[model samples]
Structure formats: C-alpha cells, structure tokens
Target: MKDKILIAGGYGNVGQVICSYLAEKFPGKIIAAGRNYEKADNFSKTTGGAVLPMKLDVAENHENSSLLDEVLLVVMCLDQKDTRFIEACIRRGIHYIDITASYKLLSDIEAMAGLAEQNGSTAVLSVGIAPGITNILVKHCKQRLGILEEAYINLLLGLGDEHGKAAIEWTVDNINTTFDVVENGNLQKVRSFEDGKESFFSEKLGKRMAYRFDFTDQHVLPRTLNIKTVSTRLCFDSVIFTRFFAILKKLGVLNLLKLKNFRRLFVKVFENFRLGSDIFAVAVDAIGEKEGKRAEYHCSIIGHKEGIITGKVAGLVAEKIYNGAYASGVFHIEQLFEPEEILKELEENIEIRCS
Candidate 1:
C-alpha cells in the first residue's frame, strides 16, 4: 500500500522539508496542507509529483470529514494548541505525528487515549529534536541504568539559521512565559535566561552556555520516564543573543519581546542577519544506578539545519506508521518506539549525530 502522508504546515519551513521528504521517498502520495492555499498550491507545483495541495484550517472546522478523509498518516508541523485536530485524525483511524512543543497540549491529547483506541488511531507527540530525540535518549539511559535518578536535557538553536516565521513567533510569544527554572528538583519562578548557568556542548557546535528554558519534555519526561528529576535548558549558536537575553532576563525586559512591535523590531534587525553558524544541539546528562553501578550517559546531537533533522524524524515516523510499527493507542514518540530502536534509525542517517 502506498503510504499517503498529510502534512498540516506543509508550506512552512519545516513542513516543506517533511513534505518533500515523504514525496520523494513514497512517491505519488503526499498532501501539502495549510491555511494558505496559494502557498500550498505553489509547494505542490514545486514538488510536481506525489505532492497534493490541500487547504485545511485546524482551528476552524477541524472535522476532517472531507478535508483529511483518507490520509494514512498526518505529520503535524504546526504548534498544536488543541486536541480537536488529533481527535479528528483518531476518529478516522489515521495515525497522527506531532512536532509541537506544548506540554498542556499533550496532556489534553492524552485524555483521549480511550477514544483513540476505539477508533484505532495513535497520536504520537513530541516528534522533533528537543522533545523527540531527548525523549529517546532518556529511554536509552533508563534501559541501561534500569533506574534513573535525574536528567538534564539541554537544547541549543542556531540563531543564524533561517527559522520559519511561525517558529520564531512561537519562541518569542512564549519567551516571557511564567516558565523557566533555575534550580534542580524544584519549579520556581526564575525568569528565562536569568540563570547565567552554562552547559558546554560537545563537538559539531562546540562549547556553549545554556540557561534554563522551558520545553514540554522537561515537564513530562520525568513522570513518563519514572525519573525523580529532569530539567531542560536552552541556548543559541551565537553568544551575542544569549548574553543579551541573559541581561534582558535579569531586567525583566524579556517580556517586552512578547509584543508584536518588538518582534517586528527583532525581525527587522535579525531576520536576514546570520550572526552565527546554522547549528543545533541537544545534550542529555543522565545519572543513576545502572545494573547497581552508578553511571551516566552524556550524549548530544548536532546539526546545521533543523529542517533536515525534523524532516528525517517525521519521515522515519511516517515509515513506522506505514509499516504498522505502532501500538493501538495514543503515545508520545518515546512511548511508541524504544530508545535503542529510535537511536538505531537516527544513527542510520535519519538526521541525528549520535555520540
């Protein structure tokens, strides 16, 4: 059976990578969907084969009765705000893969597991680098150690890389959120970047400092992995932004960044300007008693472009859905696939550098 992959944010940066990937690999079976029909149509034409143009707004009339009637798999590249979209897919017995960064959103989706099983659909969340690969690494350490005590997941983004406007918007909108943690084992109100704490990353994006930043995995991974403590941090490829943000955080002025006007100011100043290298990194530091021996697994994945990495993970998950390599229920990427299996695929060139 030809796997029909439907990408929701098909015209956006990461979605294009995912759509192009599935189109090339699966052939004559892919849908580029978004709210913008012109862009979606343009992307479909650009691909010229296997890529179909479809317009569907998840926020409005999310019922996929006619919009997503026969798609075998749906790779969501958009920020998933609600479970309606996931529920629509579940109602149709379609597999759902999301690359979103929302913990509340996943909690909402998890509430629908019974409905999902009744419909024979699986909603897989956290299918991107930070939450995606980070979860896999956690699984690996948990398996090796048999019992995990704590973990620190650090994420780094390339400020110089041309990220999608949507992604940039998401980042800035949530920038001043009541999140960010400064200490371990406790969730306190430490403004994002207020902590000058540093985490020197491994090769491919050498030595950099990371500050406490909120990503969904840090909130969900501990309970999901049965670990006592887990914290995630963030940094950029350029020291300039990191240092500046650190200061702004101290002054409590990062909240200004949440304004549209300031974001416009930022776009005008930094959009076309590549101040640093196009590199991304993820580091996992795990510690616990492994086989009754205390051990730690410190690993990282570095890449120049997230689009490439996101597309590959999306594709691999698509392949799994196509091959029925999934259990019948709602699950996160870590829950759906073992860390060893996921790491094997990543090592085999699914867009991740395992070390």
Candidate 2:
C-alpha cells in the first residue's frame, strides 16, 4: 500500500483542482476529506476512484490520534483558527502543508517549530500566491542583487475570476483592519486599502493602482530574509471596483463589509458578475546594492486562474515534501524551495518574466 495523502477541505473550489493534480501524479494515493462526506464521495467518483473520500472535521477530529494513521502528509485548503489540528499532525509525525494567508494563524504554527523538529515532522506555511510566490520572488531578487534593502510586492487579482467563500471572507474581514509594516526601515501603521501606489506590469496588465493590505508576506519577509523594508499591496483588474473599495476604506465605511449579510451579498455579486479578464499577475520590485553599486531587479508571473495556480503550487510543495526534499521543521515556502525551480515546474500553468 502506498502512503496516503489527506487533503482537508478537498471538495472545495481550490481543493478540487489540488485533488485532480495530485491524483494524476500519485494515482490512488489521494484521499479527499472534508466536513461533507457526501460531496467528497461524489467528487471522488468523478476522479474515477483515483481519490478516496473520507470524513474529516478538523475541529472535532484534530486530536483523534487514529485520524491520520495511514496519512503521510496533510494539505490544508481550509482556514483554521486553532492550532490543535497542526499540533495533532506534529504529534503523529504527519507532515503538513497549508495555503492560508492569515498572519495570526501562521504565527501560531511557527511557534510549534521546536516540536515539529523533535517529532521529525515538517510543516510548510505561506504556500499560496501572495505569500508563496511573492516570497519566492523576493528570494529570487535578493539572490540576483546580492543584498536587498527594500522590496515591494504588487498583486493584481482578476475580478472576473471565481474565488471561493473562504477567500472572499478573508478579504472582507481584513478590509478595515489596520496593521504594521516596515517602510524605509521604520515600522508604521496603515489601514487596509488606505495607501495607494501605481504599478506597471506587462503590456497586457499595464498600469494599475495598488493599495496597502496586511498580507502575510509583508510580515514574514523582513524577519526571515533580513531585508530592511518589505511591503505588499493589492489591486483588482477592475479599476472602478478598486477605487470603490479605496474610497470606502478612507471613509471608515469598509467595516460594513464585515457584516455577514453584506459579505455574502458581495460574494454573490463577485461570483455572478464578470468585469475583467480572468488573469492574475504578481510582480516584485527589489532595490539593493550589488557589486558596491545600487541596483534593482524585477520579476513577475501571470496565470489564468488564481485558485488553480494556488492549488498547483500547494501540490508541487506536497510532492517535494513527500519525496524527502525538506527537513523536519516548520518553514515558509520560500525558505524551503527555490524560486526558479518551482517556476520551471509550473511553467505550463504560468508565464514567468524577469529583468
């Protein structure tokens, strides 16, 4: 029997893609587990039994030692507030991977590094677009320039793309919250979507307005990479919608989005309406000193759908971990994998450019 890989929330929008990708690669070793066993079972049938369906509610079964008996790795596609699930994985020596962008949750997971090392379990955090690819790009830039003084990550999401409920809720919840960021080597507080700047990408993406947001990359990069300053901003493909959110943030009315009813309404609207191209792009700019002279490097990747790209990244990382590429410890994606290597593997799904 092959080692089984469990994907929590395996029936979700992003998880579906992950299941298909890994099932094709590993064949009969994938288990799709979620709160809804019916949906998981139905979805498994679509995979031609390549994926096995299992019932797993993290909140309830987290401490069940037998839950992960035959599972060698667990890919978390859902958002979890408590670290108990991660603790359980570490206790059972099951390697873990999460695609969450939440700083607080990631910080808690990081706190368990010693225990993971002791148990010979590895956990990879920051495994998605902003924190995953963005962090990797920063590492690429730093390698090119020798030393990085400042870094800026610009994210452009396609308003026309279909995003999951969890993704939408995460955006709505953070729309009004304020967070700290390092600017010019000084820490400062900035409200989400409050500060704005114009960024230029490829001709297809062109120039767009990006606003400051509390992304996990901004928090983890400076400390991990020893960079003096790192900032991350977001912008939608639709300028009108981007400006609308910015105005609401300035007026202190963005908090209304936190209302469950309003958030659901917005999610529905986003799902039903298609305002722009379904292509998302991420660009990174790094300013540093190389060869005793000031220099800059820019790198970017453009992909069709955000969710699919995110799933592909997570799947790639899981494959690496299962193949014994990573050491037993908690690590961010950038710390464990090389940017060029990952981009090469994902070339079929994304276009990468650097200058």
Candidate 3:
C-alpha cells in the first residue's frame, strides 16, 4: 500500500492546490483531513484521491488515536492556538510539514528537537514562501559568503490571487506590527508598510516595491543560522492599496479593519481591484568574503502566486521527508534538502538569477 499522507487542512485554499498536486502524482495515497469532513471529502472526490477523514482536532485536550498511527507523513495546513498538533506528530514519530507563520507556536514546536531526534522523526516548520523560500535563499547566501556582513530579504506578493479565508485571516491577524529586522544586532521597529521601498525587476510582475514586515523565519533563521544581521520586508502588486492600507495602519484603524463586515468590503474591493497579478518575486542580497576576498551573491526568482509557490515548496519538502530523501530530526526547510535540488524542482515556473 502507498504511504498515507495526511493534510490537516486539506480543503483550504493552498491545501486544495497541494492536494491536487499530490493526488495527481501519488494517487490513492492521500488523507484530506480537517474539522469539516464534508468539505474535505468533497475536495478529495474532486481531486480523485482516496482521502480518509479524521477529526484530529488540536484543542486544549485531545488524544492521539490510532487513526494517526498509520500515517507516515502529516502536512499541517491548519493553524492551532498552541502546539498540540505538532506535539502529537512528534510523539508518534511521524514526519510533519507546516506552513504556519506564528513564531510563538514555531518556538514551542522547535523545543521538541530532542524528542524528534530520539524518535528519529523529521519535522519541518515554516515551510511556506516567506519562511520556506526565504530560508532557502538565506542558507544559500550564507554558504556562498564565508563571513557575511548582513542579509536582506525582500518579498513581493501577488495580491490578485483569490486567497482563501484562512490565508486572508492569517494576513489580517498579522496586520499589526511587532517584529523588527535585525541589521548588525540592532533592533529596528517594523511598523506595517513603514519599511522603505525596494524595486524588483522581476519577470511577469514587472517592477514592484517591498516593505519590511515581521515573519516567523526572520526570527528563527538569525538564531539558527548564526547570521549576524537579518531583515525581511514585504510588498504586494497593488501600489494604491498598499498606500491606503499603510495610511490606515498609521491612523491606528487596522484593528477596526478586522471586523467581518470590514473584511467583506475589503475582499469585495480586492476582487474588483486590478491591483495585482498572480506573480511573485524574491530578492536576496548577501555581502561577505569568498576565496579570501569580499563577494556578494544576488539571487532572485519570479514565479506564480505566493501561495502556489509556498504550497509547492511545502509539498516538495513533505515528499522528501515521506520518501526518506531528507534526514530525520527537527530541521528547517534548508537543512533538510539541497538548495540546488529545490531550485531545480521549481525551475519550471521560477526564473533564477544568481551573481
């Protein structure tokens, strides 16, 4: 029997695409799980994958049933208020992949490194675009530059993609400001849309501006990789929308914008707004010494929707762990796989430029 792959939020926006991709490739080896069995089953039927439904709830108190015992790999698409889900996976010695951006929860999950190692279990957290691709680029730069001065990361998201409620909710939940990009050990306040703009001469999307925003990887990478200075910025395709949102953020109205009615209006306008394309771009700059001399590597990629790129990368990471292609234990995306192999897998859609 093919190994069973469980996707926690198997019917979500990014989850659907991943399910389709996995179903097409693996066939009859998927378990599309979520709280909503109807949606999960419906999605499974449409994707033509034999999806088994499971409650697998991550509430305050829940038990690890035998249902999860058969699963070899678990893809976490749903976000939990805590780390119960990850704890369950670790205890069961099941390989896990996640797209969560919560640093708090990731930190809690990271504490399980000892348990994961003891169980010979592989777990990959922060496997989305910002954390996934960004982490990969950081590792690549660090390897290239023997003693790097600083690493600057800029992410330009395509706002036009029809993002699902979960992703949108995630965005809204993160709309407030808290994290600061560390440059040379200096903590800089990262107010939303406040980071200065950097233009991206990317394919498909053309030139776009990137702003500094707090993401989970920005916190985890600096400590894990031992890079001195690290900072992350975010930008979208819609200039007008960015400006408007930034102003609202400055006025302290962003919290009010999270209401259901406000979200509806925002989505409605977002739907009508010709503000973005389903294209994205990433730029990584590192300054350091190579061959006993100073050198820098500038790497970039232009691809599809931010979510699609994120989901594809997550899927690839999941496959590696499930197939034993990567080492067991708690690891980041970069530690588990080769940067070149990952870039090769995404070559069909992404255009890479390195200097």
Candidate 4:
C-alpha cells in the first residue's frame, strides 16, 4: 500500500480541488478527511473511489487516531482556531502544509520550528494566493533590485469569483481591524481598508485603488528578507463595489461586517453575485539601490479561478515535500522554493508580466 496523504476539509471548495489533483497525481493514495462523513463519502464516489473518504475532526484529539499511523502527510484545507492539530502532527512526525493566511496562526506554527526540526518533520505555511504567490513575486523583485529598501504588493480580486466560505469570513472579519505593519523601519498600526493607494497592475487589469490590508506577507517578509519596509493592499475588480466599500470604511460602517451573522450574509450575497469577471491579479513594486543608483522592479500575474490556482500551488508543494525536496523545519513557500521555478510551473495557468 502507498503512504496515505490525508486532506482535511476535503469536500470544501478549495479542498475538493486539492483532493482531485492529488488523486489524479498519486491515484488511490489520497484520503479525503473532514467533519462531514456523508459529504466526504459522496465526493469519494464521484471520484470513482480514487479518493478514500474518512472522518477526522481537528477539534478533537488526534493523537490517538489509528489513521495517523498510515498517513505520510496532512494538507490542511480549513482554518484552525488553535495549534493543537499542528502539535499533534509534529509529535507524530507527519509532514504538513497549510493554506491559511492568518498571521496569528502562522506565528503559532513558527513557534513550533524547533519541535518540527527535532521530529524530522516539515511544515509549509503561506501556501495560497496573496501570501503564497505574492511572497514569491516579492522575492523575485528583491533579488532583481540588489539592495532592497522597500516593497509594495497589490492584489486585485474579482468580485464575481466564487470564494470559499472561510476566505470570505476571514476578509469580512479583518476589514475593520487594526494591525501592525513595518513602515520606514518602524512598526506602525493601520486600520484595514481605511488607507488607500493607487497602483497599476497591468494594461489588462488597469489602475486600481487598493487599500491597506492585513496580509501575512507584510508580517513575514520584513524579517525573512531583511527589508526595511513592506505593505500589502487589496482591491476588487468592480469600480462601484470598490468605491462603495471605501465609503463604508470611511464612515466606520465596515465594522458591522465583523459580526458573524453579518459576515455570513455578506458571504452568501458575494457567492450569489457575479457582476465582474473571474480574473484576479497580483503586482509587486520594489525599490532599492543597485550600483549606487536607485532601481525599481515590477512583476504581475493575472489568472482566473483563484481557488484552483491556490490548490495547485498547495498540491505542488506537497508533492515536493513528499519527494524530500525540503528540509525538516517550518517554512513559507518562498523560503523553500525559488520564485522563478514556481512561476515557470504556473506559466500554463497564469499570465505573467515583468518589467
């Protein structure tokens, strides 16, 4: 029997993509585990039993599960409110990958670096779009500009795209919260969606008014790359929706989105609405000194179906880890893989622009 690769939340919007991709790549080695046994079973049936369904809840204690004995890796497709599941993975020496963009959860995982190293296990975080692809683009730009002084990342998401529930909830919850960011070599607090800037992504994406958003890249890049300043901004493709949110943010009405019921309602509304295209874009603006002269570099990627793109990135990372491409420790996507190589792999799925 082959080593089992368990995917938590395997029936979810993003998890289903990961499950399907891995099942095709590895064939019968994928186990779709989640809280809903019926949904998992149904999905497995749809896959012609290539993906085995199993019931596993991260909320409960997993240290004693027999399933852990047969699993080689755990791909977390859902949000974890705590670190117990990660600790359990480390204790059992299971390789892990998470697509979460939560700064606090990532920090908690980073705290387990020593334990992961000691157990000869690997954990890869920041495995999705904003933090994943954005981080890789920043690394590329930083390398292009020899002495990197500052970097800015801009992300534009299509309002019509079918986002996952967890992702929608995360955005709504953070829309009004304040977070710390590195600015001019000093830490500063900024309200999410309150501060705005204009950026040109590409001729196709055009210029967009992006707002300061609390993405994990802004927190991880400064210390990892030794950069002086970094910031991340977000905007939607719809001009009217963008301006509407900006107005709500200015009026302090965005805080109402922090409520669970309101967030759920917003997610439902967003999932049902399809006013814009399904295209999403990411751009990086880097400024530094090279040859005693100032230099700048810009890179952008435009694609459709972000959920699938994120799943493909996670699946590729998991395959590399399974093949012993990464050392035993906790790492971000950019830390373990070269941006150029990753971009090459994704060339088929996305349009890349560099200048």
Each model's TM-score, in the order given? 0.90, 0.96, 0.89, 0.97
Model 3: residues >4 Å from true position, as ranges?
Answer: 53-56, 60-62, 186-188, 203-207, 251-255, 258-274
lDDT per prediction? 0.76, 0.89, 0.75, 0.89
Per-candidate alpha-carbon RMSD to the true structure? 2.7, 1.4, 2.6, 1.3
lDDT of 1 at 43: 84
**Backbone clashes in each candidate structure, one number apiece?**
0, 0, 1, 0
Residue 276, candidate 2: alpha-carbon lDDT? 83
- Return the lDDT, model 2, position 267: 72
Give per-residue CA lDDT, model 3, range 1-355, as digits (tens).
3278988887777877677667766777878887788887777677555555556565634345776767888898887887776777778778888788877778887889898888767888878788888888888888877776677788877787777666666666677756666667776666655656665545555555666677777777777687778877777767777777777777888777668898677656655664677877788877777889988887787787777777788777777676665566777777776688688899987888777
State how far residue 167 of model 2 sits from its true place (Å).
Answer: 0.2
RMSD in Å for candidate 2, one decimal?
Answer: 1.4
Better of 1 and 2 by TM-score: 2
